[model samples]
Target: MRFVSKLTMALVGALALFGVGFATVTPADAASGTIHFSIVKGGFFVGAEGGNGVLEFRGRRYPLSIGGISGGLVFGASQTNFSGRVTNIRRASDVAGTYGAAGAGAAVGAGVRVITLRNEKGAILRLQGQQVGLMANLDLSGLVISMRR
Candidate 1:
């Protein structure tokens, strides 16, 4: 019993040391920035959206392009202009990635829209904006954003 207790204590001490080391090696906290973009979407069964935007980060602006395709119960057409904050990013380039989007919306004339999407790199875009014209959709989409040269 005495030998077992000593071995258990030794194992616990090693685990504590390992945990501390790993914690110290973790990545730094991410940064956030502002973004503005516009998208025009329309279709019958499958829909497509694309637009251009700018990212304001670290007191500089970077131009960006957005495009995506969506399927399932999509119809009509409309344009959406969004402005919001992109978080969990380390740099402006980190905002460039494939973001998975699943949403349902309907609009006639004009309406308010809000959505939160996360990319593979863990960047999250929380956007809200105005959508105009006639449109409706219930689908899954993949939106890709890239920095322009």
Candidate 2:
């Protein structure tokens, strides 16, 4: 029984040390608030999208400028209005960066899409938008977003 108690105490001490190391290695990311944006896009084969938006963080609204380009079978022209919530936002500048994704989607007359994307700054955006006009099989990627002055 004495030997078993000593072994248990050693195990507890090891776990405490491991917990300290884990906390030091991985710090928690601060979550800020939701962001709202609207973009208008148009092109044939190669296309561009841009518009204005606002970020509602900490009871304040900051305006943003949205811009992007899409390639691969980007047909016709369309306008999209999107709103999303951002998480793991450590700083105000974290929201401004390039978020990459290769998604093929089509919209005729009217359509809706929900997408979740993570940027290089470790911020994740859950976006849902309404698309109008027409588009087909657009493999969009390298979408860059930035703050508007």
Candidate 3:
């Protein structure tokens, strides 16, 4: 019994240390900036579809594509939309491939939250007027963004 307790304690300590390391390695949030764009359309899984757009932040131009799904409900009505942000202006393929995937995932996740809520409307809003924080990989390629309007 004594030996088992000591082993369990050691295991717990190791797990705590691993958790700390993992938290430290995760990417921090993106700095505040303005992202201007227009909503092209709306429907279920709506934001997944791509539309031509531009994102202006920190005096940089990020050409955006909306190719993700968005869905939600508001005032007894259902809706969906697809959209994605531009992370790399110079590397469109990378943005469309990797960064796009990451952005899509983040957008879908955020959209789901609105969907699950009973009293929220399904709308594809712009990121420019909202406050958003981005948690991305070390290379700044893949990212997870959380936002508040």
Candidate 4:
């Protein structure tokens, strides 16, 4: 009886140690890239925006297309140019996903804007730049991005 109990305790300890070691293992670090894009938006109650951009990653440049729509209290029109860093992407294609934002802001003539958005694939975009013309909005917006073939 004593020998059986000792063996059982030893087995349990070994399994716990193995489990902890496995749990402590970490995943590979994700890569990041730089991007620049410009979008023009306008509407009354509903708004639409589209533009094109380039992603510089791993010593290469990839062309990207951007489009989105917003619904709610949206009024006016404006053009915004954004330049920023995209992180948590393994490759250029990972940057092609749907990113959504819900907020309210207005721009008259010239204004500066900063925003952070994330996608389903765990890619995050930290963007900030200048907005020109005139625009105002309070709505939910979803932006879709795709690689130019």
RMSD (Cα, Å) for all candidates, in order, is 5.9, 6.4, 14.8, 5.9
Better of 3 and 4 by TM-score: 4
Q: Please, what's the RMSD in Å of model 3?
A: 14.8
lDDT of 4 by residue, 1-149 (tens): 99999998898789787774433322365789999999998999899999999999999999999999999988899899999999988779989999999979999899999999999988899999899978888999999999997
Record all residue pairs in model 1 with backbone atoms less than 3 Å apart, i.e. clashing.
Answer: none
**Model 3, span 18-101: residue lDDT tens:** 785433322242222333333332333222223445544566566654433433321111123323333322321222232222
TM-score of each: 0.82, 0.78, 0.29, 0.82
Q: After superposition, how far is residue 22 of candidate 1 from its true place, in Å?
A: 10
The stretch of ten residues in a row with the least summed lDDT in candidate 3 is 113-122
lDDT of 1 by residue, 26-95 (tens): 3465788999999998899899999999999989999999999999989999999999999888789989
Error of 1 at 65 (Å): 0.3
Better of 2 and 4 by lDDT: 4
lDDT of model 2 at residue 41? Answer: 72
Candidate 4 has a TM-score of 0.82
Residue-level lDDT of model 2, residues 1-149, one tens digit each, is 99999998898789887785333323464766788887777777887888888888777777888888888878777788888898888666778889888888877899997989989887889999988988775576666778877
lDDT of each: 0.91, 0.79, 0.32, 0.91
